[model samples]
Target chain A: MTRSFVLAGALTLALAATAACGGGEEPAAADGRGPITLTDTQSHEEASRKIIDAWNAAHPDEKVTLDIQPKDADSQRQRLINNAQTKSDAMDVIMLDAVWTAEFAANRWVDELPADMVKADELLAPTLETAKYRGKLYAMPWLTGTGLLYYRKDLVEKPPTTWAEMKETCEEVLPKQEGMSCYAGLLDKYEGLTVSFAEAVQSAGGTVVDDSGTPTLETDAAKAGLNFLVDGLKAGLIPEEGITFKEDEVKNALQSGKVLFARSWASLYGTANASDSPVAGKVDVAPIPGLNGPGSGVLGGANLAISAFSKNKATARDFLAFFTSREQTKTWATINSTPVAHTVLYDDPDLVAKYPYLPSLKEGIIKAKARPVAVKYGDVTAAIQNAVYPALTGETTPDQALSGLQQQLAGLLKQ
Target chain B: MRRGARWFAALMISPTLLVLALVVIYPLLSAARESMYVRGEGLDADGFVIEGERFVGLANYAGLVGERFVNAFANTTVFTLATVALETVLGVAMALVMHGVLRGRGLVRASILIPWAVPTAISGLMWRWVFQADGVANAIIGEKILWTTEGVQAKLAVIIADTWKTAPFVGLLVLAGLQIIPTMVYEAAKVDGASAWQTFWRITLPLVKPALVVAVLFRILDALAMFDLPFVMIGRGKFSVETLSALVWDEATQLRYGPAAAYGIVLVAYIAAIVFVFVRLLGADLLADARSRKGQA
Candidate 1:
């Protein structure tokens, strides 16, 4: 009897194993003419729906279904990767964060797009650069943005173009105002910190990684950039709470009339100028301050990529082209107040008249640099956050932070 | 006849055993197999990164000796011990209060269970706002403290949030234990001139040992796998609050599935070892109860 029971157990185990490994049928391929799903985050759900509606109207035969993913970038990326890894044809087109292009392309989860899919010359240089993995184009640039210096125009005579001027203005003007802090940016220990750190390094005339994708954080320019933030925090020019500020917090700080300067995205312009905002009509935008002059900001935006496992790759590619087209991009920018990849729209007379910050935002985006393009970008960004967070919180000096970061990046990128 | 009965019993339980094997054993075995292989790294001849797995038996396990893994291990252990211990004491007190309250008993019980009812992620967000630098927590203390930033403060914030959310769960379980105790035992102790504290120690405690053991066991298991509380309360990758689950999640999300599965196996082994020790030591009564039930059957 016991032998029979053991035999039965073994039989069940074998059956279960077979059941587990049995689901590997290849997805059937399809031509470009069919219904396809677009998996994107809900941040721009309204605008995305409008764009999809426009596409569906223009081409009734090739219908597109909008599948809204999570609003959080990390969750959205995980969902896309999970779907691709499972070889699911659920998502034909995906909206990828600019930083995820390298990871998706390296893993062959995203199909490489043709170079002529979009007008490469008309798109901003930094935005176009984010779409490429190695030398091949993997995604098409969508909405793009950069960090802009938001300052209270009513309080300061003019926006500061240098870190020294910003500090001097903070020291002079801060004491006179009640409950006011100096400057705030995305300094929390997350992806935003990495972006801000890269911006700082680049603004001080140093790059996080060189052309060969090697760590170059040991330079004096990197040190000066790190010191810009470290010294600001130490001297109370950047408020103590700024160490914990993210994008929303920094934007709130400026809009509530609590901060003299805030380094945030261009979308904050619309909100800061809203009639309900306390600082409405009092705030103005400028290029982010640097050691000497206007500093470069880290490029921030999303891209459209066709999933490698998708059955309807043709339809996906066509939809990407349609969505990132100049006309749709302008509509997206106006409706969502998103910074567009089309460079000419930044200087469009009508757009500039409607949004005054577009000119300064264009300058920031023009000088912006993409974060390091690495196959293991997840590890790279985590290392940056780990290495830089301590310095911002007064646990380490700027010199130590940069050197430590150099070592961390070197180990991470050694491959 | 006896053999026939045994066969019938086996046949009756076969479906349950089959389901268990498919769901539990299968995934565990799959994760074990995955842990032995590492994904190919770097680019291939075509400039695309090499795809597919390469067999590197035990290398992923050995690679867990890094500082990040050690820190996560330490954080996980500390959070489990701290949160479980605090929750036990507070939960017991709440259960006692709930048992004794004659007036507004429903109100008291419901209020106590409210925190437990709210979803953990929601509570994490609510506590985040409260723990903000200029938030109500600082307003109450009248001193600016960066609770969300790195260091011990962030760890404390996580522990506090976890304890607040789960203590009521323990209370609910223990209250069930309290309700089952017969009033006759307390009366007998009273008749023997026992003090209130002495009665509680001798009668109430021993009678509730089985229920308490089960509750603590469940708590220990749950706390060891704590993820959402810390992940939501304190942001991810913060050195202060990273746990084993978070480490696994981080690795998996970064497409390092091999290392992630290895971490998962290590975490499972760690939990199993702790549970075994706990059952052998403090959970003797739990086993005794099971044995008695089987003997009766």
Candidate 2:
């Protein structure tokens, strides 16, 4: 029934494309209700507003507001979900994990981008695919991240380029440096384990699943990458203490200069290079290592979407476009250390001076890859983490452990 | 006039039924309907299967009966039963001491309730910190126990955190039960030449049995639906502490509404049946004994 009305509206719009807007005593107020407001859950809400304010100064007609609820990921998601379900339209824009965009798009819980908001081809080529369902965009890819190897430049002359090299380097350097472990493998039974594991697998040119989304961890290439994690646990190159580690734990280790190399999202740069960090002067970040293959990393990023249940579509889309604009992108990256997805942001000279590592880190952004962008992506990730975490902490063999996980995810997807 | 007052009494009780319908009844019905339907792409599974959702009959339940599902379910069942049993036993003992012939009763009672008053999430995080390599527990153990690393340790960590957070609640309940026992019953038992153990068995035990059973059963039911401690400690991704609640939350978050709803429905049934059976079978004799004693009182 809704589809017929939509089709009829589409037909009418096609006939009168330019004259679709109607002005009357009761309706159709212009100037888009005095610009748009987009709510973000990113930590850099103030910086975003400052940047948007500057843009508005140049173009005041395009006023946009950003609301950042930075503290809780779950509350943000639940608020967005409840709002959408209730048709409250509480948020004009939603900042969502990159993995979520596909699910959002699939549920039709979000609206497709307007014809002019963004060019499909012009967006981050690989990353844009994550925001689409059935080849239609529901979200705009904004900032992005991939696992990078953060090492101490003052302590280590050369960083490791492979799993083997990383272990050897850690053994050589960790003994001399009092607090440092060789590698900060997130042995912590958390989501980050899967994130790091995916990076290792993809860096080796391995597929976690086939096109149909079947898990096949019994593969030889899969274990080659899996062994790196298991071997690290056995060698004590990574700490047993790391099994209790979360993102904050590893971040604290890196910030305290207690770990030689840390595998983390590049977003860590903001915190690692901050004045509060003990190793701020010493840390440098590079790509995750590969063994006899081109390096790869799992994408850590988010996108902005207009909730389908939102009452205000124009405002949400405006916020989506405005925040994603190359100008604001540079401002966010410069101030907060969030890597801008827009390739052109790398050219900003002021941002470069603020973050000298931006140029070095661009390689990771250029090569950033996403996990399987399915509605079941979350389930797959959960299962994979469940499988890999045990092996990571030496609870089970890489084969026996992953064999179960491989079976589980495949079984789940099939169901 | 009296009949009108009885009618007014019924009207007053209706609010609770209205609340029950709104909160518990509606969600359960919707969830049950949602479980029967399969989610395809787009809005394929929106309303009831008859209305919009296509019913898949028992596929959802059958699918969840697999290895991962069974593993999580068995783990949850074992964890809940074990934790509930341990906490209740410990809580009852602690409560008896608080109400028993003991020194510093007020201080002990006050200190014991402190753990229960702490928020589950905060207490869970605190326990996580305590179990960390450099944290208090590891320091006490004199070895860096990887609390969040292994399945065994992770479960133990959750059990510890949960017991810390909830045992006080059980203790308070049992303590209330202990207070209800008449002083005359103990005096009579002493006059009968009863020892301390015999007094406890003959007088105190029977008197508090109902409250103790009620507390234990209540805790058992609550522990069945456990989420926070496990989630905070091991997280959802690691099935090391993945209980039914986390699994359902995970499925819902992932947009696997069918499986989530399916698991949710099954979990509700499991918890309700378990609680009901526990009270009906376990509480019957205790309830009868308490009632006869109350009649005597």
Candidate 3:
């Protein structure tokens, strides 16, 4: 009887421990004052640290701390999600990928910002839209990016404006260059693939998802966009190794003088022209090619949001506004060579001289479309990658891939 | 007196029991509970996602019949079997080489262990560069095999990297077993006119079985839960290289807690079942050896 009593006591203790490990209770809000932390990826660490150091020097009582996350986009998103799920007060401010704004806002992990938090009118319209969820502003657009076609001007005097022209150029140029491949982009099975696929569909006059968050992959334009990639691979226009190229790989291919034409972010312009680059003087940028003309780019970049569980929400809000102010944005743009969200910077004379690609980049960003807005965005992208990758690899036809994606997305969005 | 002794023993072990209960048992129970419910979906009037989980019984498990799950499950099984089989053969050969090298033995041992000492994630990145489209691997082969893309080559790349990293561990364990075999056994065989091959087949193989079994068993468990190497080297969502752990991670990161937990439980069941079969076949010998040692004492 005594032994049994001991066992029962142990069992009860275990049960209590299990109960305690359940979801945490809603935390009481803290006053908007004190030292707070900002969680961001290491990609912007240098600029972020400089900004934070200046802010901390000015505001002694409310000094900001920077928590650097991994440079990988997927890893950064997962870390932010984990912090929110635990309802921790660790992350006061978060740098969210523009695509994640909807998911974060819909889940209430981030607080909706006031309409007048920043001079929203100064921000580019396409980028400004990425900061909203259901008509309410949930984040402040910090940096913006769009895809550009990088070409070796010496090899090809004129950049192609249409998909057919790109193919014809590749046919004419690749045979002359012994070691050079025609084109490259992000074709790996990850988030980059999703972006590349979306650009293709949009360029072909199709939408991956409509305004109502419904799958719209079953269209002639969508097939045409997919065929551009599939046929390119089949015809050896895109080298077999292109299937493994991510953002870094694509940039490296162009900088290393392996590819004649490459599709990558605007940031590649600065790096490709760096002094040590092999193709430094030979490189030039153009708008992404399309079925009929210059295609649209998918908007890519990060935004700043106030974590809902933060104790110093007021400080967080103030810091965000300070971070995105005209002066700070200029500092970030010049130092990091990053494309800022401010519209005026694109046309500034001195800034334009330093970065000549800004005009074309601004044009691409203006025409760029935001990725599909869904609360289950993680699942949605996975489904797209799952469907589109096989098609690119020759395992499935474009028709099958799109239909499969349509059915999978229908089930996901139905809930 | 016996009753007093029993109570004292229980008291002595209760702290360890409590710690285990808090860490292991608690998580297992929590995950089981989590698997039985689904998170509320869709947005509310204010565009915020609806909160709270609703109980759905085995619906999460039922959802595992999808193609992605099946592909992940198959990949996990194939990776475990292929890796374990290759590691055993390669590890044994390495052990023999390490055991026989009289010159520069220390150097040989340390160099062999370097791969195992490198962290899995770091080594994964190192190998990724080696397997790049224009990397050293292709340069040597003179064929541009895209090792990182979705194909049989991707699977082979992961297997080759995993074997290279972990075969040293198996070799180390086997070397310890090799050292423990008495010189007298070999002397006795020599006196009886045994060939080197005959002595090895008859004596060395039997003497090393226990350590070999334990090493293979550990490797089996480790391989069954493989994640880092494939994820870092080949990336996620690749149909050719996705494992069960990657699938669970993909789901959890996507905020589908219920399905992730269900996959976790399924993986646990899979590992447990394999271990049970393994012990039934080979672990019986280990227990018998332990029993004989105790009897001798």
Question: Whose TM-score is greatest here?
Answer: 1
Worst 10 residues of 1 chain A by lDDT: A24-33
Clashes of each: 0, 1, 0
Candidate 3 lDDT by residue in tens digits, A1-415? 4684478458656666866776777866874788999898877789888889889999999999999999778888888988988899999999999999989998889998999986877989889988888889999988898999999998898999998898888889888888788899999888888899999999998888888878888999889989888988898788888889998899998988788999998888888999988888899998898999889889998889999899999888888989899888887777687788999999988788889988989888998899988788888888889899999989998899999998998877755
Which run of 10 residues does model 3 chain A get worst, by summed lDDT? Answer: A1-10
Superposed model 1: Cα runs more than 4 Å off? A1-4, A27-31, B293-297
Cand. 2 Cα-lDDT: 0.72
Q: Put down candidate 1 lDDT per residue, A134-231, tens digits, no spaces.
A: 88899999878999999998999989999889988988998899989889999988899999999998999889998887999999999998888888
Sorting all predicted structures by lDDT, with the top scorer first, yields 3, 1, 2
Residue B216 of candidate 3: its Cα lDDT? 95
Clashing pairs in 3: none
Docking quality (DockQ) of candidate 3: 0.55
Recovery fraction of native interface contacts for candidate 2? 0.30
Recovery fraction of native interface contacts for candidate 1: 0.65
Compute the lDDT of residue A362 as modeled in candidate 3: 89
Assess candidate 3 and give its TM-score to the true structure. 0.96
Stronger candidate by lDDT (1 vs 2): 1
Question: Candidate 3: which stretches are off by over 4 Å?
Answer: A1-23, B289-297
